[model samples]
Target: MDALQGFGELGLGSRLKRISEHLMKEGQLIYDHFEIDFDPYLFPVFKLISQKDGITNTEIFNAVGLTQPAVTQSIHKLTKKGLIELIDDDSDKRRKIIHLSPKGKTLLKQLQPIWKSIDSVIKSFGMETSSSLISHLNSFEHKLKTHSFSKSVIKSLGNRHHSIQISTFQNSEAEKTAFYDLNEEWLRTFFYVEPFDEEVLSNPDKYIIDKGGHIFFTKLNGEIVGTVALMPLPKQNTFELTKMAVSPKHRGQKIGQQLMQYCLDFAKNLGLPNLILYSSRKLENAIYIYRKYGFVEIPVEPDCHYKRCDIKMEIVF
Candidate 1:
């Protein structure tokens, strides 16, 4: 039992502080997982600045309800970290305007989805009915303990990414070209397109679709942004997950991972026994994601069908 809970109303302030610290630590872990260099404690000030391009220190202090000196110190730290810049106010030379630096803007782009996930998870914790402040805190803490806050946030992000619709491969001319072009884009980037790759990509319907296989694509606002396919293997009731690619413009949005999940679900619905994939170890991020999705590495045959493949992985349903 927490001693702070024993103090009841008398320890309200300490209780709130303890909760705040716990949340801040979790927030920091989330940022670190995304490889973002940000302090969760500085969020209020930074978020306020992000809202208003040319905000003033006085305005930040007033809006966040922080002491003037604390707000000033936050602005100082942000400036020192190169996340925000202080510029002379055009109307008043004595006053300074705060703006996010270019690096900060880039970071914000990376952080928006993460913030959405955090907001979603926190809002979910508020759904329980509680009679009093302390009771509410207890319920919230219980929920946090029951479900990992960080994992919840990450799962929320996956759901957000799924908002981009994934559809089965339609035999439309445009979609056919998309399937070919998307695969070619990645192949040319990481490895040369061998004759086998050209023939397979050029004729997905013949090589994959007609051979008792399936293809899936993710569309963003009616534009096909990503795709993956499952080709039937010679072994009965097994398929090779292959040709996964996301448009370069949409690479960072987890479209690839979303496609992987969609294919897994499709395979499960079909009652397939297992899914196999051949990938190169040089693609570290893709390899890691495959492993995360429960794909175990297997020995690659010396005469692997695809010359570019150095690693093979499989997941049993």
Candidate 2:
């Protein structure tokens, strides 16, 4: 008899329950080495608070999809352990602001290397498979947020660039030509508009050299296929992500996501609180990538360069 028939005869629901218990035990054994409590829900609480510090209890409850009492109990436990603290809102005495304590911050900082090590171990099987998995997970998260859940229907267009390099622009004509040539094709496909003046295309190198911002380019076999510019915004404790473009032939290869991850990792290493980017509505793929990387849409300001651009996104590091 088939396994299903056997299970049906032996109470499939009970067998599945036992299997779940066995998996939980295995998971616990795997996590015991890290000395982590291994409550999957707790990390989400910490992440939510890290993203929006001083959030209210009710807001946490809603965001985490936990009942009010469950959230209250978790908060109580975390507070008692000195992982988090509650601060009273000055304007509204009734509202208590929840935030991570110094110990919690230290714990999070310490967990970074451990998480990265675990990630590397998990992704060591195959580079292409690992990249595809990460991209699919990001796309799934984006779709879930937009209430557009679908199965793994992502199609890969065969043209994929394997190697990507990051570097500051060199003050050479060849480098300038490569930058502009990449951006020219990118703008045409990404924005679907007529190309900008040749001056602006050539100005990134000079602008970065003058403004003290870093220019990183993605090169595939000596050809520039993607580019991103990170510059300081006028506001205090904020940085701007600018000129993120990828070549048309390399669209679905998750190059844009990798570039954004690089920018975010750079910002975090610099200890910046937030990073901002201005994007247009027409570029849905770019917008989706931004959102996948935890960028929340915010109100646009009048001074934004692209008048047709109506979307602004910000992410707290």
Candidate 3:
């Protein structure tokens, strides 16, 4: 009944292209469901740009194994979408180097978890042995027909979210140590720990708890994998959502978002006037998440608490 199946090995290239297109279409649907502005066709080029940090058009063309014109067009599309920017090379003013824009970095954070889910689902399909390329293709196509790829990915993400648990600060020493450890892990990874950070993290009870503030931790399968603090600010009826960190191994599982949502809900229930947060502009993905949660950028004072605080944001209840 199917002419392509009848053609067999002779149509291998065409069949592969057809399957690629199908997967891409499903990828677009997945992005749509998540409200992400992206084109699945540009994923190869986009992914390359993200990994390379900075690259040239020629390099992208070679790396992606695409025609020069195709690479150029993909670059144009990414630029138009405000996901990337081209800057003049310092060595050669005529040469242009590509880098991810702030929006692109934000999109990367949103996409990485989804990418993992996609990889997991596709890898599952390839687990069984197949006799030939044609046999594998046939089985893959059949599985696609029977299963909704986009739905499966969404379900996978949902299951991950459901498995996580949020808990308030407890008196356990291990829990207290997690607060310091998780915060220290990220600080050491991205920025060095300041004396102020050390003082506060080392004594959360004296600084945060006794001062009418709250701390929250995220547990994944009984492991404390993330922590956040809602510390009372100098301003009346306000709190600063600070010292938030997710364990390195659990970074991509939306643990940060969960802690953020819990803090917002906790603040709301207490009838707080507003919640403020200080952050570095260098943390673009984190800033994007703040904005996503309805936090608006506010001016940072000349004497802000942390030296690394370049930006301040707040959300009113």
Candidate 4:
């Protein structure tokens, strides 16, 4: 393993790329087995275009996390294959937007079940492993942006990494205030708060704790920075993770990752087999974290609590 993966995270560019290439080969085989004319390395670009039709090339680079040249080459391939088309923007003739051609749309429609199978198999991987991979990747990227990885390694080469403390709500006024403040800050930023949000945020003691649920908070430097709730379902052994948020000042600092880790551990400790969540597509960052922890999007419930929820996902352990 040392020969295969040297120096751990401090030196892992080649190792990560090696693992990625190996996985990409497996993914290509999956597509080939289904007789789909797709390249696994280019799938992210295609999928992003499908999800965000008419999105610009720059947007694809950001959303797909690929180099501009890589996205450009894939787009060229798709266009040449007649699976996608680049159209000049009506508002800005200089800019071209990417969207699926009729051929791509119909072909994807036909491959829906194949995609479902791949998604299911990936979700079958260990929840903790998948979650940690996504969490660490996000943390590395965040750290890299704020301070280069090489610099960070020199600064804290031998010391333990910064960690957050998790605490269960104690019904203190200050804790309740933090809970409401944190959740409200995020809700207002992305979506309007609904009546149900008010009902739960205002009285977690009644709606959550007293009703077989637990709310956990993440504290950093003696301040409550994030909160999450695990509400037991009416049915047995089921739960929902709701009202999760971290301070904007502390956002992208891996506070949410700690909150989620606590929730996942607590759920398993209590013999829960699955954890569900409801969110919107607009909350792409949140969705990525959820999926990292093995949450797969399920059909939306007809009577979900939040009006803003367009996507429902769950991790079935």
The C-alpha TM-scores of every prediction are: 0.53, 0.47, 0.62, 0.52
TM-score of 4: 0.52
Candidate 1's error at 230, in angstroms? 0.4
Write one digit per residue (lDDT tens) for candidate 1, span 217-288.
999878899999998887545899998987765665767777888899989999988999999876655777
Better of 3 and 4 by lDDT: 3
Residue-level lDDT tens digits of model 4 in 47-155:
8888875889899888878789998999987786667888999999999988997657755664555565555544433223335554554443333345433232223
Residue 43, model 2: Cα distance from true site in angstroms = 40
Query: After aligning candidate 1 to the native by TM-score, how far in Å is the CA of 77 from where it should be?
Result: 30
At residue 11, candidate 3 shows an lDDT of 84
Best by lDDT: 3
Model 3 — which ten-residue stretch has the worst lDDT?
A: 29-38
The lDDT for every candidate, in the order shown, is 0.83, 0.62, 0.86, 0.72
**C-alpha RMSD (angstroms) for model 1:** 9.7
lDDT by residue (tens digit), candidate 3, 291-315: 9899999988887879888999999
Q: lDDT of model 3 at residue 138?
A: 85
By TM-score, rank the candidates, best first. Answer: 3, 1, 4, 2
TM-score of 1: 0.53
Q: Which prediction has more favorable TM-score, 1 or 4?
A: 1
CA shift of 219, model 1, Å: 0.6
Q: Candidate 1 has which clashing residue pairs, if any?
A: none
